[model samples]
Target: MSESFNWHKAVTKKWDQNVAFWSEKSRSMWNEGSRSGIIPFVKRYVPVGSQMADIGCGDGYGAFLLSEAGYDVTGVDISPKMIEHANQISGDRLIFKQGDLAELPFEQHTYDGLMAINSLEWTEDPKHALDELYRVLKPGGRLCIAVLGPTAGPRQNSYRRLYGEDVICNTMMPWEFEQLASETGWRTLDGYGVFKEGVKEDVSHMPKPLQQALTFLWVFMLEKQ
Candidate 1:
């Protein structure tokens, strides 16, 4: 499915209105781990002075972390509402733009690094998005992505099922992600899931029989051809 099935006005409207939900969720996960987790992970591949692009940078949370590390960061998202929130919070540290991932508005080989955390699944076409990502990145530039796993447990599965979202939603199992990277003109340097201490908070407060799906971090530090 190209997400066209669920790409009605109502869906986009709901996604836009859910900015608070996303912002709060990101704050607890990626933002909280910026210094101790994300920065260090980024430092492993992206160096100081590098120009980076963050696709689907929800509220620019991770972009802030990357900018603090001295990278010139630009955050792009499909939601203008999300971009507005990002501009308010990110200030001048990063540039936020309302744009689509599949049809990125940028020149070729313009960046030294690109980061997409948990946002890959949101793109209308993940493979095409990756192709665009590779095009805008310079040769040897790094592409870092973290996606969800297939067996993400009941908490995640239940909500997605209820919402009628894609189960293969934005997630790609380790091996599948690796294959995606290879086919997209990237050479993988590292890959794996970094599980946090617990399950998603949404499911945390839910009832029993709902096994909290352990959040798995599936990241790949890849280099462009």
Candidate 2:
């Protein structure tokens, strides 16, 4: 079944269907929701006024935030509808384009930094996606990524793969991704977890494995070597 499944097409169609609702809440998400801290995190490592790309940039609101924060931002999403909505936003330094993660539509060494919030997991091949991301960044450029944690609801996208089905979601754990990044030439600069609301624990002081186990999302700031 996996051999015959077009995971890329399916994933794009799924996001296309969700464009309306996703675009509607995208701004709130970037401003003061679960995504509020992501741009700030990228800002911490990526210098202001840098050229950056936002992968899986739904509706491009997050890209807008990056531009507002002083970066020249380009938003890329696999879904055409998402790009259409993204194009509606007016910005002198923001660009929106429809493209795939596994095969990004840009020249090599083109960006100073990149952000891929909750984006890598949905790729048909996260490794290829990561490679493409690397290909686009100048040497020593920063990359900020947010991967859904073990208990994230979005993990359900890959659950059916247990039954020999194909899925866009790759079951890549936070620690596993860290290893992959290291092997692929990314130097981890910082790492942290974003937990769900309500319960609180000082996961920061705990081991990386323990912190990742209880997070809703695991964010990493890495440098391309």
Candidate 3:
């Protein structure tokens, strides 16, 4: 299969067979990082009453948060399971749909802002996806993109390497990611390395390599040119 198809399949399988597991993990992050760190950062630039689109928005938790914050939010994901979960969790505050990130179904200039947290790394064509984002967003719309950095600590690395059995695809370094974003016409607005620390569910799975390397590195925010 093509790389893009393979990545899509991996996410599909995760949602179909392991939706609860991934949802719980994503939910945990929503409480601390997505709610407190990410949403606040995005809100700083996106004015109130703006229309926002959250691409690759698994389970729509982020979209729910943004809608609750007063943005007209539409969340889209590739996985039906994810969209279903999101619809169930979100109620009327957020709208959830299943769609491709690279070929969003929305019309041109549909939204005033966009958010793609931890979702770009899974795309086979990051540049194409960003171009679509540029098309859907209004002129000078703010975009906040967060992806799993190349150095996401030992535990995650170990889990993907061991239990995932190499099903994990690729992760880009910060500089490479920034270059791609810029080349795709996303202006670098304000960005910072966000670091998050957490232990595994079991003590036996803990790694003793804290501070051994940069863990959970992600760009905070950016904008469409």
Report the CA-based lDDT of candidate 1 relative to the real structure. Answer: 0.71
lDDT of each: 0.71, 0.88, 0.72
How large an RMSD does model 2 have? 1.2
What are the RMSD figures for all models against the true structure? 6.7, 1.2, 6.4
Residue 166's lDDT within candidate 1 is 47
Q: Give the TM-score comparing model 1 with the true structure, all chains together.
A: 0.79
Candidate with maximal lDDT: 2
Q: Which ten residues in a row have the lowest lDDT in candidate 2?
A: 196-205
- How many clashes show up per model? 3, 0, 1
- For residues 1-225, write the lDDT of model 1, one tens digit per residue: 444565434335555887999788776676465223756777888888899988878778878878878889999887888888898865455899987777888999999999887767665567987899889999999988876654444125325645655443454566666788888778988654555555435544543223213345556688997
Q: Encode model 3's per-residue lDDT on 40-110: one tens digit a residue.
A: 77889999788898898887777888888888888998888888888887445578888887689999999
Clashing pairs in 3: 118-146
TM-score of each: 0.79, 0.96, 0.80
Clashing pairs in 1: 121-170, 166-169, 193-217
lDDT for model 2, on a 0 to 1 scale? 0.88
Overlapping backbone residue pairs in candidate 2 total 0
